[model samples]
Target: MPVCFNPLDLLMKNITPRSQIKRGENHSTRDVLLRLFLLLGIFFLLFPLRTVVAAESSGSDQQLIRMSEILRNKEKALQEKELLLREKEKRLAVLQQELQQKEKDIELLRQRAEKVLAEFQALKDEDLSRLVAVFSAMKPVAAAPLLEKLDLPYAVEVILRMQPRKAAKLLSAVNAERAAAISRSITSAKAAVE
Candidate 1:
């Protein structure tokens, strides 16, 4: 005959017992084996899930730490780049100031050079005028030979500076070829101005 076990009785016996059982003395083998198997089953069923959850938590923590580290590194790199940019801007500002100062100095030098050149040109004009006066005081026959010996452009310039009456007398004394060439140069110069 098969023994009948009630489900309610088994649950009630496992939940609460009347007798106080001593350790390793009056326990049945079946009872001990059943409890051992139950504990093993619980451990097998729950341990892997707990391990999976712990592994996922650990992975997430590591990832968060890596991301934080990456962000910090990026922020540090940006700060360094910004500092370099500021330094470059400061250097650029200094260079621009230097360039402006150099330009000012160049302008002052150019002005000085222009003033010196103007003064030299005034002296040259004064000398030319003095030469014209000396030539005018001379006899045309004497002045013409001296003027003819000068470069053609210089001779033309001296003649143009003289009074028209004095220039005509001097030209009459000059060689015909030189007088004609001087006349041609004067005509061309006037044409160019027009």
Candidate 2:
């Protein structure tokens, strides 16, 4: 609540703080001009230094960003190459499986052919001879298809081994022109052999 101030008329005390100076009594036009000149000189000296530091920092940061982008692109290219290799490996596996399956199928076909050939081999020799005899005795045109299924030389031997008259009668039952040709061949073969 107490406020006291000393003016020029106060007891002649010379104690003074520069911050507490009375502006109207102590400041002059020459002092203000000197302070302003000092402030302008300090600002001009520092400005160019600040601008140089800012430019150098910005340039370094741009170089760092370009290096990072190149690294990212390199990583992406490696991933794409690995993907292509994996696809080729998968396709090779499929081809190998198909080749193995084809080999298995071929083995099955060979086994089936062997089984059918064995059944034909099991017929008795005397039974085959009896059948040939019956065909010769009956002298039926139906016998031609069965005889033709046999090897040519074996069929001719079977016919010649039978009675000549019976074998000729069987040939006579076939189509006239075809029978005549077969009869002539058989007679000539028999004569030449004898």
Candidate 3:
């Protein structure tokens, strides 16, 4: 393999005069080159330090002012976050309370529905006479819905208990065959519940 040398090294070697380069009182060329390299190294090493010192000298008060502003901004943001969290918590609490109240309302509605269902279940042919008795006392026009809630026998009893005029009118509105059947059975009917 062939050897290869740097171009700058070859140039330096060719420029040597008087068979040797000599040291001088003022400074040798090598010494000047060394001093230049040292100065360059010192400048490089102190570059960031010089910048910091310059910044400190020119704007230390400004730096402090900026730091305080940043701190205040962070504090405000923290306070806003805290306030938002508290508000959210309050809203959550209100929603929880509303949910609990809704649950209570639902339970009450369920209980009332059960009670109504029980009352409905308790009614049967045995209560026919009692329904008729109540319908007899109530106006026919007003008692229709109550009678309607009852079974066929009870409804017939209630209709028969009405005044002849009203009963005739209601019977006309009612199914003829069913009304006749109820009219025949009502006289012998008694209330019974399941």
Better of 1 and 2 by lDDT: 1
Q: Candidate 2 clash total?
A: 0
Candidate 1 lDDT score at position 126: 90
Model 3 misplaced regions, further than 4 Å: 1-55, 124-194
Q: Give each model a TM-score.
A: 0.73, 0.45, 0.37
Encode model 3's per-residue lDDT on 1-194: one tens digit a residue. Answer: 88966444543554444346456534467755755665676678679879888888769878889999999999999999999999999999999999999999999999999998888767744465566566666665576555555677556656765677777655655555666776766655644321
Compute the lDDT for candidate 1.
0.87
Q: What is the C-alpha lDDT profile of model 2 across 25-90, one tens digit per residue?
A: 867555555555545655775587678877887788778888888898998998999999899999
Q: Write model 1 residue lDDT over 12-120, tens digit each, in one string.
A: 4664243666665777766767676667776886799799999999999999999999999999999999999999999999999999999999999999999999999
lDDT of 2 at 12: 23
Checking candidate 1 for backbone clashes, the offending pairs are none
Instruction: Provide the lDDT at 79 for model 1.
Output: 100
Model 1 TM-score is 0.73
Regions of model 2 farther than 4 Å from truth: 1-57, 117-130, 139-166, 180-194
